[model samples]
Target chain A: MTHRVAVRPSGVELEVLDGEDVFTAAGRLGYRWPTVCGGKGTCRTCFVQVEEGAENCSPVGPLEREGIEALRRPVDGLTRLACRLRVEGPVTVTKRGVRRRVQE
Target chain B: MMDETSEPATARCPGPSVQDYLDQDSRPVPPALRYERNDYLGSEDIDTARFTSREWAEREMRQVWRRVWQFACLESEIPEVGDHEVYEIGDDSLIVVRTAPDEIRAYVNVCLHRGRKLRTGGGNVSEFRCSFHGFTWNLDGTMQTPPCAWDFPHVTPEKFALPEAQVATWRGFVFINMDPYAESFDSYRGTFDDYYIWPLENRYKSLHIAKVLPCNWKVAQDAFIESFHVIATHPQMLTWLADANSQYDVMADQPNWNRMINIQGAPSPHVADSVTEEDVLETFYDSRSFYSAAQGRDLVMQEGDELPAIPPGGTARQVLAARMREQLAATSQQDFSQTPDTELLDAINYLLFPNFNPWGGAKSNIIYRFRPNGLDPDSCTAEIIFMSSPKQPGETPPPAKIRWVPEDTLFADIPELGVLGPVFDQDCENLPYVQQGLKAMRKPGITLANYQESRIRHFNQTLDQWMSR
Candidate 1:
């Protein structure tokens, strides 16, 4: 029932139980992931690269879709919102550094 | 070439031609949404009376602020795991946290048990645990631990989840609203896309300066929108950037997204106007208006030498001239053209509706967020965050401390001015007194000036309209 989550650049990985949100599990493991809107998927701060097992995640919700639209990223195929993504089997997530010079 | 009256007999009629007359009459009446000049409340109304009373202040918060979106923090504040920052706005406190590698979450600062505040300031935390009873919730807001779980029967994690707030980020800035049914953040932004969408997204954070102000939030917010006050309220700012003939432009009016683009130059040397070329030249050379005289000394070159100014344009003179022209043009057109096609400086000031104001410039990106301090109406907390782009990722942050002299400190220098400085000192210093006056006043309300402070009037009018709705 354990699922794998991997972070990029830092390459930190953690395990979570099925049905656990990537945000919740990482937090329990003492790893920080950025989220505002409290994992409701309203703020795109919980965005991650679904390196593997994209099919294991849940479909994009309204809030995640809204965020993806704001980011001007395509939401049709692979990418999934981590807050909305339910752990199912093995999956890897990559964290990308913000491209802007000024961090919020 | 001829005598005044008699010359017209031989000369052209000098009257509008049929085509000219038709063109003049045919010109569409540019959107006749007349904003009432006197309908707004003034500083006198805000004096010691209204600002100090808790009940009056809470009513104002509900009528004016609760429905509007407020700037919470920057995405960079919680760039890594467990990084978090606390924001308080009008009796509400939200903790914005980086819960996962690419996740950020916000929750009400209160703990479910006994309603005590969970976290104080901000830091890295795997879980937010209530200090009162050792109840803990994971970053996602799910209950993880509770003392003596066996004692409480049928108590489930879902039953005691931490309350959450609506959060949205546009161009690196994060915003949150407590009202669940509030309109989407995009809708609230109105026409900000035309000016900020690109530059804000492209820009990086170089510096972060935060301060707390003591005045009612509106007063601090009002200090930013118009140049009318600069001449009197901010003498240093006036000496540095403003003039009598400075133009004003209302960028967007759907929800009072008004901004004044004041400049001291003409469009071109050939264009006819009262502002002299010398005045324009001086406007361009006056770097001391924005940067400190000490800072400008290094950038301003002698007569013919070349040097880079605080903003774009070649030398200090040309930079100032270009800035003036840009400001003047934008003011006249009611549009923003200050930002170039490709460069660092884009927006001068982004006055986000309600409570947030982001003043953008080449040297720094200063953001202001004003929130009510507590249940008390007369007092509000102003969080002034000063941000700058770092030369490199690991480069040192600017000096965290700012020096302020009590007598000599201008509104700009007081570290606590936004939080507790002379500016906040000036504003907050008067709020409590104003609140007391409101409670004691026997009459209905006060009046507002028509022209000098139109924005303030508009703000009150908007508040009335929203509250009525």
Candidate 2:
């Protein structure tokens, strides 16, 4: 089963499969997401503000929490690490200020 | 600002912090982890002719360049079968290719038919087809097709197989030797296993930068072999690097190999009298914090922040290293948890033969290779490769394409170089000046310090030995 993930502002919708992370889902649909840590949840560069449907994403893992704390990036309860957020149902999110640098 | 006797100051720690954490089973470093060294090198006048004279360079191309085992490319660079890299030295270019799942082959990159250069750069190809004449050879250099078969009645496929060179691998580095009867690579590279047995194969090349330097290859290579120049050339490092006190150990039994173990998190012995515990703390905190920030980690310190307190019973170096290990464990899935403080903080730099300098470590481990720009006495190709341990088993990072920076380009333009850019920029600035000085100086030779520049002396002796052959 696939759930619709609507990226706000861009209004791009991606059909995220079960157990697929939001970052991977977005990447499949030609949406660029920063993956500095190669999606290990170590680098907080892959964060996205979940505008709605937090229930669709997986509960924040230990690594995700540690990343958020370590990076000192304040995230509201709705903010989800795109690399860590496994899509469960329909969701809406906006990409945070993160883009892959050409050199990196 | 108060008088010395009035207040009780926080006592700085001594020795390594992680030493206390080690139990009986894992405290002692095994024999495999150690490298042998001999510090017996006599001071000798290194002839300036080797650097400035084209005649010497010509002789070196035939004798030294062909004879010595030189780094061709990384095995990771051509991971797929049929992928090849054209490694050129002097007038010779060898196509180092992966022919099978496990086997790698190297052949002179010249077409047998018309002697046209088969390939210029690196790429994957099922067979090497000459652009000039369409003469083709299999990945293993067996002649596959001669365009218009009737044109070459005298040439048979069996007899026209491309000539091959001796190829060997250490860790992930592919080395090639052109000499028909070169010594067994094991015997030739006796120092490599003993010194860098640190699972270097587990690391993947993440960055590569090459630039043409206006200096002899030997001069560019020699600049990096010793830390003594850090005092004069990189004076800012005087606050951290133990330049004078740094141990320069040479394996006199081994040819053209030496290791310089520079003590980091300490001031240079040149200014030992002025060094204080606070200076050590500041250096450790600043360098570690800066390194963390460069790696996409949040700043461990802020502007005007107080230096981290040295842990009890630990020196500043150990404290910083221990914290770094913790940070690494927390940030990355790669388990460096087993690596001891001694190996983690060890700032040992090894110079292997003609030109390969690699420091021991996972992160911040930089490898340098210098080569003559195809027999140019006044110019050399300086390559810098940055590597880190693979995050997963059998994981290979993408082969970083060599970014050749123009001489006029600012070092600041390449932010991926991290802190190394400024340090290398300084060396690049001095290389041309040194080259010009070598030509203009009335002195027939260069004099090296007896103890400090022993690596340079050892290297010269090895070069002389190779050149004699």
Candidate 3:
């Protein structure tokens, strides 16, 4: 199973395998997502807008909740943490313009 | 409930009592009165040339940075056991490693036997053994095994442990002190707690970008301290991102830290007073109005009033600026007069002395670490990390891709430049030149103009004070 994730502004798209976290999936597709905790769900830079297939993603956890509140990001179901979210099916993601490109 | 076992006993250790360290006579040397050297250069003197020289930089490392609490890296950089990262400050090299679950250690990077560098780069290991002679040291810097323990019968592994530096962590940032007698990290950050309201511990690392430069560490640091040069040095950034000559304020009263606030549209461009309530409503309304107008969406105005006329000089930039001004104004209307409603502030840049600066705005926040290149006086390296909040739980972390824009590329084409790296490069391009110019000065001394860049003067004064003592 695979999902299609598209980054906005740059309009780059990639196919990610199912069960992969959004960050890693993005990485597999040659897209870099920002993750500070090295994918432990801590830095909160991997936010993306789920334009489609929101129900196919994993549920949020305590760590992700704490990170969102600390960063004061808008709390809506549409936005999800890429580090915490694992893909269940096909989905599309939109990256925020202001966020920095992931540093290798 | 607080986990007693997980927390270090010193975690709750009381900070130095007011009488013990802050009593008028007993206070640590004041940053203002300590160094009175006339040879120091002001902020304007910062440029690339000064960074490349190896000799002049060594003097600064000995005199200034050796006394400061330098950030090693983020704790998450070495999250798992045996994970490691090597950091070089001035001529000194130190390694930070996770030796055990929930335990991290730092040590001078040199080997115990022949004094060769222990590890080439970062990696996981149960023990770090020097490849040259197989001198083995545990992750905690304890000497574990000598190549031939029986041959050197008199030598004790326990007695030859690697030296440890004073290390501490606050909000996930690892800081180390080379001087054994240096004050505690909390004391070093004193009175600046209010400025670091971000939940840094809760925050994780998103990206880490480093660049080796040819200028002094101070030149790299001073670039972030003030916005005064944005107009001339970064014309594109100033046009789109900031208004030069904004009102500026500096918290000189604090020790080992400085807090500066810059208000938009203010004359000094360095600080600003708190925003007011009317500002927020107007900004929100204007943003909605202009965005609607540009997209040709229907204007949802109050029944009695036509959509408020777009104000004069209202470019999209002005509209965006108005929105920020309004948000800050609304936040100021709240009863918390003592603290700025960080939520609404368009931009806030915090400078941690010696060499750390963290800046945040409505968009994202970034952390910068500057270090001297291996005890060299003229060259340095800077590390930059950009971060943002996660949108929801269970969502995957953001991708770590960065679009590397070459020096010749215009700033507008680079999306991330406004957020971190490019802006830093703008500062970097000039530092090496400044370093070179400083060395060329026949007299080798430069005077600071009081009104233009007082922060630089203040920094040098503080540096001299700390180094002399």
Candidate 4:
């Protein structure tokens, strides 16, 4: 089942398929996700908050939890790394820099 | 934890970083390995005069060079009484000598007679006899005689003895401080010892290659302090070394040193998505081939050993580190089974203030010492020494002789350097132009990356602290 991710403010929607994280899906759906380490989840620039349906996202893995605690991000406990985020249903998230890729 | 909530300086965070690997490591990592703090050095352009000016060089000799502890030479370099080596910094030189079985001393290398240098280089000698005149000093720095003592009443033993510098030894390194009132070398070194798992004293110098580069000492020193240059300067390393995600740290308790830990066996963050674990292993094998050959040991890939397969869900680093641990355990006397994979495989480098770098323990046995090539501010000597573990357990290998690579000789041409040669050459290619650019640039100061090149900035801040006085 394909999960829809509605990036807030910009409202760019991504069809994240099974095993595809939002960051990878963003690439396939022709949107540019700001990232320094690509989809490795090393660079925290690609983090986002699950504004709606936090329960729909996969459980936070150890590396992602470590990243959250180490970086001390998310005033709330709802932040998930877009690169590591997997969802089963439609979810709404807030990220400032997600935008459609400009065709060359 | 870094207290990142209260610390605005460390706001730039990296995930899946060196810490993730450390968290997975079986062995407990030290605070030194886990430590993270950045004393926010404000954005400022560094004056070019710090590198290109003659007066700037003279001031460093008087202020910073005189005040800090200097790594003169290894204690093993002067193992016996009367054995000495002359170390020169800027305009000053000192004779670092082994006075007795348990004592080492450093004295002004100048002759009291007419201010001529007493020793030109390193050698084993009974006493220091001034070459220009017949003035002599005993191994302990006591005035022995003046050729015409009766004619020279001013040459008294107490007054004419060479002025001694404060001396201290840590591990196998003999360090000297010209300022008699400077802090103890122990305090100066601080908790820097917390990082070294493989004691440097247990290793012996196996290769020494000093190359004169056309750049300021700091310019040459900065090149090795960060992994930021790896993606551009050492592209081949990206296959197995994680550069951008490498940990860059400055301990608040110890500002005198900064650390960088580059995890190998992982693709660099820059090329993460494109590379596979199998590619990482193949490249890793090629990288160690030369150093393995130089040591007369093919531990990484012996004659017909097949490439170890990286199991699904496993990492190349884990596989390679396991191979190294098993090899070292069987071939040497040390217990390596519990050694952390990071210590076994990563580039765990630390730079002490001024210019002393202990790269890491275990298989990566590299140490770097950078100095101004005598009084010249624009040129500096960069020395690379491989201090390896004993091939025969308890046997300390003979100290390798220094081989100065001519300024024009590419490091790759040097046989002893093995694979490190080309890497050094690639760095050397940019330094001369960098020096020239700094001189001719319109900008008054050099700009630096806040996180990646923070070590260089921290070094400059420390240099400013020393020179401020």
Candidate 5:
């Protein structure tokens, strides 16, 4: 079953499939997310604060944990790499610089 | 500011770091990694004319190329007395020959009698006999016969010897200097020997691919010297390469040489958020096949071969490096059990100034040489030498003949380059346009990433410094 990811501020909602990360779903849904490594957990720029449905997000894996630890600032329970987070249910996230492809 | 007894502290380099991956290596890493970093050159766009101006290229040929110790040929190429290879650089032709079992000498290819080139090709020769006038010189470059014994009364052995270039051998690689009074090769090389750990003497030139590129020599060279181009030029490598996190070192001690350590077998931060361990491993399978073919070594994997999956917590680097160690330990006579992942898996690229690139690694040790393609200024010849480990320890195999492909033929069309060819093609395609774009762009210069492209700036700075003299 596909879950809904609501990117805050931009209000861009994405239908994320099982085993798919949040960043891929955003691109698949015609949205551009801020990134240098582009979905690689290395840059950690595509990070989000979970505002709602925390339990629905996938558990942080080793890769995501390493990336979070490398962040300059301290992380709380809501902070997660958008590229590594997968949702099982409807979730809300805050991300800056998210945009939809302009339709011609 | 208050730590008086400790080493001087420098500013921290931000962003994803190669040191993080080095700390992740399961095996002991190279001690060379402990050195301090150099200051940034500057945040500036270098002049684009270096790639397009004919006058700039001419100045480089006279100023830079004339004075540097250029890598000519390997000692194994001329192990026997009288074995010779013709090395052609910008407007200069040299005959590198083994004068004795232990001595190698480089002579100006032109015969003293006339301007005709004495040797057309490399092969075993009793002497260099100019087919034009039959003015012959022995293997030692001493004048032997003048064809007509009584015709010339002014010829003497002392004045008649072939004009020689300064030649030096370091660990089996022969380097030649066109300037007779040029500084000794040891001094010109600087502290490169300190960090370079690979001993090339035990390797043989298994494959040599020389292609004439349609851009200035430095343009072709700048495409390399950094992994910054991987995101656009070699996207296939991103799944297993750490492009942004790779280390770049520019030091005052080794002004003539600069180095970079690109961590292979790991996902580039560019794709790190989305790529998984399986995806990284998958790409390696494809590249590993081609890398083996390029080296003419037995394929580490065959068609339908099952891959050992990356373990639950293990990295692609750890898994692949372990596999390489197993392959080397089995096939090679030397002990590879203790070789670190950095040596076996990292792309340790080093540039010996002007135009020679000798990589440091236990495997995938390739060499690149770039020179102006016959004074065109707009064209260059780039050669890649795949250095392979000998079948038996301490044994040297005959070097492969340099294969020159047509300028228009894509590197992908070359059977030996395999998948690496397309990556090269991407680099080649951009060069001509870059040469033309540099001429057409409204901007006077192009900006560079202060940290990533520091190598390019270091080289250009060095070139300008040399040219001003």
Candidate 6:
């Protein structure tokens, strides 16, 4: 089963395959997400806001919960570890810390 | 260099270097095994100007850096899929990533679209999306998407995969070769099959230090291949560093391997003064203290005000080994009972051609790597990785990021260096001075001691082979 994911601002529609996490689906579509620890759920650099259809995503795993809570800045409960969060239905995600044109 | 007034280069016990150590107390195969010298390398003169010449550095960059297998990063650094690290050599940058649970891949960090450097440092990425124009690539280097795909009619995903390099792993170190047709890792590291007998894959990097030094990479590397400088640069070590009695083995068959076995608990012959048993014990305590520091433990020595007498037949090496085993067992809570005494008591520094140095034995805990800084012949980055036996099986902690020390930052400022800080500080200080001295020298090149500096000579000879190619 496949679900649709809409990337905010860029207005790009992506097909998120069943069990495919939002972070990976976005990457599959060439929407680059910031990740320092890759998809290991260690670096937590891939945090993203599930602005719409939060219930459509899989429940947060332990690693994502710990990472989000440990974050220095307070984050909304809907913010999930993009690397660990798998999409279960259609959703919209707003990636934080991503800039279209930025210097490394 | 050993003084003319000192005794001959032979070890205290006779026979082949390996048999001599085995005869002592049934030790394992010594790091410095039976090895004959390559006469061709012995007579060749090394040009001192190579240290400061721009043309020579460029040639090395083209012929050596591009062609040789260089240490990219440790496998432990990127244990999970999508984990990557950027390794830059000369002007090229490579992104080493874990494509699967067990497989690692290397790709040129340049975006295939416009050739902009794709990544700078390291991080996890689902796919490599170039920040400039949003040209993205999957972890395996396949083009995932390109901005305005319909506008670029000529660009096809099949022909535009990110360029890749040859990657291989030895122990837990990930190595990359930029040359597409370079020789296999085994052929490149010929005699290294017997170089590390102990388990190297079991260890993980606990401390990662990278300091920019003002010297050619070779100059910085030469400072470490031999223990001759221990007397002058590390004066405190004169009491126990067997500088003159150390075994220097050169591999005639293998151009990429050499070893120096610096026996601990013995006095440097260059000191010319008789060392007391107390002095020897002090040196042992120093080593114990340092090892304890690495494990975040403080060792309290049992010695009193007066130095204890040496047990009738006991040598400093034996006494030190016994004490170290007990201390390590207590501090680390691990059974070292089966570990051999020789591995605990000796400083077995082994070098691979180009720039890979790993000290041998269970007690050995540090590895060093040197590389030219960008294109500058007068500057290089010296990386020191401190490793320890795993406290618990399969529980090795993740490695720390590379701590970059400034030009003036004291080694003591870095907690990870622990007790070895001063020794590293001494070497770091001497490299720049040596680089300056080379610049001032009028002679073709300085001479090397035949017996003690054999490894340095072998390294330079192997370097010339790669440079000539």
Screening candidate 5 with a backbone cut-off below 3 angstroms (N, C-alpha, C), the clashing residue pairs are: A37-B270, A39-B273, A39-B274, A40-B271, A40-B272, A40-B273, A41-B272, A41-B273
Q: Among all windows of ten consecutive residues in candidate 4 chain B, which has the lowest summed lDDT?
A: B1-10
DockQ (CA atoms), all models: 0.02, 0.01, 0.02, 0.00, 0.00, 0.08
lDDT by residue for model 3 over B237-273, one digit each (tens)?
A: 4323233432223445553555343332221222113
Alpha carbon lDDT at B369, candidate 2: 93
Error of 1 at B173 (Å): 0.8
Q: Which residue pairs show backbone clashes in model 2? A: none
Best by lDDT: 4
- Candidate 5 residue spans exceeding 4 A from truth: A1-104, B1-15, B149-151, B287-300
lDDT (Cα, tens digit) per residue for candidate 1, span B127-186: 776656656778889986466789766668889898887888877778887777888998
For model 5, the chain A TM-score is: 0.89
Q: Best candidate per DockQ, number?
A: 6
lDDT of 4 at B308: 96
| Candidate 4 residue-wise lDDT at B416 | 63
Clashes of each: 57, 0, 85, 1, 8, 5
**Candidate 3, residue B302: how far the Cα is off, in Å:** 26
lDDT per residue (tens digit) for residues B141-250 in model 4: 99875777898886688888899899999889999999999999889877777765558888888888998899999998988888889988999989888888878877
lDDT for position B285 in model 3 = 48
lDDT of 5 by residue, B349-370 (tens): 8888887798888874788888
| For model 6 chain B, the run of ten residues with the poorest summed lDDT | B10-19
- Writing each residue's lDDT as its tens digit, candidate 6 over B1-469 gives 3345544544242323433443564344444343334332453446887798888888888989898888899999899998899999999899999999999999999988888887776777677767567677888789964668898888988989999989999988899999999999989898776756766787667778889999999888888888888878888888866776677777667888887777766677665267865677776566545333554222336545343356887776666666667767865667767666667767777787788888877653678999999989999999888767667756777776788888899776776566577788998889888899987888888787766777888888788888887
Question: Candidate 1 on A5-92: residue-level lDDT in tens?
Answer: 7667677777887878877777677766776445655445677777787777767755456557656788973566667777677777
Candidate 2 Cα errors over 4 Å, as ranges: A1-104, B1-36, B287-306, B311-314, B392-394
After TM-score superposition, the amount by which residue B45's alpha carbon in candidate 6 deviates from its true location, in angstroms, is: 3.5
Residue B310 local lDDT, model 3: 40
Q: Residues A1-104, candidate 6, lDDT per residue (tens digit)?
A: 88997777667677888888867777776666787545756556788777899888887654466568756534454788888887778888886544343346
TM-score of chain A of each: 0.78, 0.80, 0.74, 0.92, 0.89, 0.80
